[model samples]
Target: MKIKLIAAAAIAALGFATSAQAHKAWLQPSQTVFSDKGAWLTVDAAVSNDLFYFNHVPLPLERLRITAPDGSAVQAQNASTGKLRSVFDVELAQEGTYKIAMVNEGMFASYKLGGEAKRWRGKAEDFKAGIPAGATEVSASESLGRVETFATVGSPTTGVFKASGKGIELVPVTHPNDLFAGEKATFQLLVDGKPAAGLKIEVVPGATRYRDQQNEIHLTSGADGKFEVNWPQAGMYWLETASEDAKTTLPDAKQRRLSYVAVFEVLSQ
Candidate 1:
């Protein structure tokens, strides 16, 4: 990619939480459904208290991944990190769906050396080596987080919706680009690339700053890892869910945190 995107080494997200007061991270595209084949799509990535409003900090795109309609990797162009958000552009040369994702995996550690508290955040592979000698009360945790948004030039394609089977992910049974208000959309939630039954899903609409209530919708995946959402209105919505287990890839880490966040635009039918 010609754009100077952030490095994965720079990611410092603490962990994933479903708290209402927690700052939510997201990616918002200028337009979700494009009519032209060669259209240009711009995206803004940020983390903030009020959904879609960039107030807290810019989300680093070190682990950013773009997949074209043909299941090919596409490089972002003219990308830049600003004070409040990171901006990027993608040329929709194909006439199908494109997936823009920021995937991250790292560790958070806390220990004591010489009776002093110390903390670290970086790749999980470095968790053991990064620990200083004589560090007592050493404890660490691994985290995997993904933020994504989809854009389609003409018609949406299913090739870009494949799951990595590593952390938690969403495989849309109902095409994302085909979402319509008042209609129910179905999706398969996966953990470790398998059906994630009984996982809680949170769906919150944008423009939360104007409403006194969050209006967040909560749903759970069925036994087959499928979940359904009936959009109430025509607007951009933030959907997120997380799962935790003792399946840490690192020996020193005791727990693994897996989270998924996606932005979807529901059109009025």
Candidate 2:
């Protein structure tokens, strides 16, 4: 399957979060591809009165719907998470065009007062399979602290990353042409020169402050030995990966660690 990951500039610009009335909400990968035999749709909502006072809000399943080209509407199933943000999974069978739409009520008011609702539309195709050779590994980690002030927000105290096993190559998704708003990107984690399994991956977008608190997005690996999320907004962001086992140890103490984390710009198309 040809998995095209699109990282487009956010249609809406990022600015300071001033009051509860200015919080914004939107879907990532505003565009997308359906190539997996079965596909999963992951939605993240960021609510901020101003950019600095951002909160990852949990959206209810009833708030959104996925409608296929065939006119079949699928409801999203709630996924597990430890944070305030809510994740929903929708299974796609035969593919064509799909539209993700939000219900115009309830939480819609919160999003509207803060911002507005947006949609991600695209095609879903069959995903191809094959293993690549000589894969490299990349890893990264960063410490998150509460926001103290607007202008002098402190840097992460400690950060580190490591690659799991052997075969997986960790490539930086940096170039503007590499990702867009409505597509999905795939990277392999190899084990002894083969696709690795049970790896832990973390994606952190730049931090913004709201109500004197700091907010970030965190993703764990799925059953496919891969971690995927939609990038709807543009700004500076980081992708970090490490062996699931290594997570048990402190960042300063770890063996067999190979990680990658780099800063990338998500520009508007």
Candidate 3:
């Protein structure tokens, strides 16, 4: 529910250090199964460019939440962080798909307009209203990162596909939990509840605790805001997309950006 806001001035102060290192957060569970009781799943989390490489670090519990099959909260406990990634555990008491998500709300501004770098936090509306009156030219991208995945126990369910009312959400056209290797999976990109077009989405094989890479496919959403991916192998897979509007709506920031991520496992033959 919180995003790290980057100000136009801050970008200059740091000399735009991390601009090239774009990252996406992901959640991976050790097991997806149903049980009578005492069923637990170990989740490995990280914000990285590669699957599970942990090159970017992991999200804290405050920014992470897991919803149970019955639409209840499933708390993650025993969290520990390292240089590349973090790990946690969650106990499941029901049979259905659980959604684990990491959400951040923030804005990015470019200092290229000259003068001092401006910094703003909190809501996006506040940043829009607070733009300096004297400012003539501004270039920036306000982004929201909505990263999530589904872990299903017993049989798969459709309840986990509900939108969280975030900026850009990936609504699975195919049941995410039912994916299998060598099959096709489709998803719709929802921008403010409607299908979004021309968005860029990437599908890649998830990283292991070590290192590996398979086929990485990049595609653009069609007129219907939908895209499909053919699962190559088994293990874990990552799907991500982002879109931005830079036309400046007025009384609002000059630019806005949005990003979405989803990870799921495919059964191997």
lDDT of each: 0.83, 0.34, 0.67
- Sequence-dependent TM-score of model 3: 0.77
Ranking the candidates on lDDT from highest down gives 1, 3, 2
List candidate 1 segments past 4 Å from native: 1-20
Q: Please report, as a residue range, the 10-residue window in candidate 1 with the lowest summed lDDT.
A: 1-10
Query: Which of 1 and 2 is the better model by TM-score?
Result: 1
Q: Candidate 2 on 44-63: residue-level lDDT in tens? A: 43433333222644323344
| Candidates in descending TM-score order | 1, 3, 2
| Candidate 1, 1-269: lDDT as tens digits | 10001112113443322234457789999979999988899999988888889887888777889999998899999999988888999999998999999988888777999999987888777777889889999878787878889999877788887777898888988999999999999999889989999888889999999989999998989999999999999999999887778998888788777778899999999
Is 1 or 3 the stronger prediction by TM-score? 1
- The runs of at least 3 residues in candidate 3 whose Cα sits more than 4 Å from the true structure, single-residue gaps closed, are 1-23, 33-37, 112-141, 208-214, 246-252
For this target, which candidate reaches the highest lDDT against the unseen true structure?
Answer: 1
In candidate 3, which residue pairs get closer than 3 Å at backbone N, Cα or C atoms, i.e. clash?
Answer: 2-105, 3-105, 9-117, 9-118, 54-84, 142-257
- Name the best candidate (by TM-score): 1
